[model samples]
Target: MPEVLVQYQAEIWQAIGETFIMVGVSILAAILIGLPAGTVLFLCRKGQAFENQVVFSVMNLFINVIRSFPFLLLVVFLIPFTRVLIGTAIGTAAATVPLSIIAIAHYSRLVEQALLDVPKGVMEAAISMGASLKELIFKFLYVEARSGLVLGLTTSIISFISYSTIMGVVGGGGIGDFAIRYGYQQFKTDLMVYMIVIMIILVQFIQFSGTTVSRWIDKR
Candidate 1:
């Protein structure tokens, strides 16, 4: 056990860093793109602001198709684009392109759902006060839906963290890669257990923190 640790400690640390980087980049991208896309999605479906049936229909189909794809398959399927975009397909950075793309599509729906949870009455209240589209979206929609949106993001970030683990199969490097290579391939059961536990702890920490923050923000 000591020998294994000595041999692979560097690899484990490197993998942890890689995983954090991947998940962080993906989360940022998802928030940037998904929030706007989700708002558009919610407001354009059959009614609401800027409703264009054709645009909504087309975007709806596009989001659905992308979201329906399995994350692992999406990574593999986008190899060409990843390479073209990043000039490689086997590192943490390269893997992030596909991860972010999928994250955006997946979280966009979550964000839209969160926004939908806002009371129609709240929106109407803003409109009755002569709120412009900008005010409606930035203030009314977002303010009322802030709690749900935070939780949705909390859930998406955790999922993205899990997904980042699989990037190891393609040399993406992360704790998952460390587990697979040292734990599974080398039959180091203890190492695998440790890695799994670490992942769980990371997730639980995020969940607790997110919940606390959300409850604090959601003043009813």
Candidate 2:
């Protein structure tokens, strides 16, 4: 067993690296897009910042549609669109396209929920103080609710890690592909077990770090 591990150690590490790449890039993109999307969703809703019933309904429907699709079908469904954007539909890069979209849709709702947790009075106070819209959002909403936002982002990232595993079905190189090829197909239960252990540890670390940071930042 030790010898087998030693022999495939490089492959194992490479797969881990690939998994990190997929998760990291996807999460970053999700944050960039989802944050604004969620902010807009929040602001456009009834009785909110820029409340527009028509715009809110449209954005809400779009988000719901994207979030409703299962990840597997989402990957398959995006094959054509993915091909158009990246010129191929099977690889880490191609895989990232769908993963990012999934992350954005997933995280946007989380962000919206987090922002909603902010007190209505906070907005009232900020506006009364003559705060600009930018100041109200960035300084008041985001700053005051930062801990919740962090927790939301942390949850989304952990979910992204799990979702990335499914990318193996499309020839995306990650721990999932590694496990499917060398562990399941080759009947190497040991490798499979190792992968599971690694994933567990990764999840634990993410949870721990997120919680710790949230606690540290939280004044209330």
What global local distance difference test value does model 2 have? 0.89
Error (Å) of candidate 2 at residue 123 is 0.2
Error of 2 at 84 (Å): 0.7
- Residue pairs with clashing backbones, model 1: none
Question: What is the per-residue lDDT of model 2 for residues 49-158, given as tens digits with 9 covering 90 to 100?
Answer: 67888988998898899889999999999999999999999888889999999888888888889889999999999999999989998999998889988999899889
Evaluated at residue 107, the lDDT of candidate 2 is 84
Candidate 1, position 161, lDDT: 88
The pairs that clash in candidate 2 are none
TM-score of predicted model 2? 0.97
List clash counts for every candidate, in order. Answer: 0, 0
> TM-scores of the models, in the given order?
0.95, 0.97
